[model samples]
Target: MTPLECVELQLAAYNERNLKLFLTAFAENVRCYRLPDMVLTIDGKAALGEFYAANRFVHEGLHAKLLNRMVVGNKVIDHELIHGLGPEPMETSVVFVIEDGLIAQVFFIPAKSPS
Candidate 1:
């Protein structure tokens, strides 16, 4: 699958809260990092699945609304507004790096509150 296709598939799975289908877009050794500092947050597909299943998919109202998307080569950058994690919606930017038809790495940019 192409990079954008893989990303879109994952987004669909995420919104559906389907852990099995969500994992299909990722590589076995996928790594997830928090950007700015590039701190590693999730390592490997198993951990990714576990984290989302236990921490995320359980939220019945959980959904990420895509605000914008930009594809550059093998990277897909998405601007999203996420709901159900808290009382208020959260916005974040996620960068997905695809390799071998699967997502290999992801970097998340947390939203900054306006001063």
Candidate 2:
């Protein structure tokens, strides 16, 4: 699958809370990182699964609507808005690295709001 398609699948899986789909879209030893917290790495599907289970409740019905996507080889960067149950909607940038049709790594950054 193309990088964009892989990212779309990943986002869909996350929105739907489908652990199988989420796991399938990622490599066996995938590493996910969150911005401002470089040392936090979720390695392997089982560890990712545990993390998802713990935080999934906060994201019920959460979905990402991509506003822009830039692709450079196996990497895709997405500017998106996340809609879900929260005080306010969120905007973020997601960087995905795809290898052999599976996501090898993902990085997230909180989008700055207009002042």
Each prediction's TM-score versus the true structure = 0.97, 0.82
Clashes of 2: 0
- Highest-lDDT candidate: 1
Backbone clash pairs for candidate 1 read: none
Q: CA lDDT of 80 in candidate 1? A: 100
lDDT agreement with native, every candidate? 0.97, 0.81
- The all-Cα superposition gives candidate 1 an RMSD in Å to the true structure of 1.8
lDDT of 1 by residue, 1-83 (tens): 99999999999999999999999999999999997888999999999999999999999999999999999999999999999
Model 1 collision count: 0
Candidate 2, residues 1-115, lDDT tens digits: the string is 9888898888888888788787788888888887866655688878888888776635776776779999999999999988774667789888899999989888877776334
lDDT of 2 at 56: 64
> What range of 10 consecutive residues in model 2 has the weakest lDDT sum?
55-64
Indicate which candidate wins on TM-score.
1
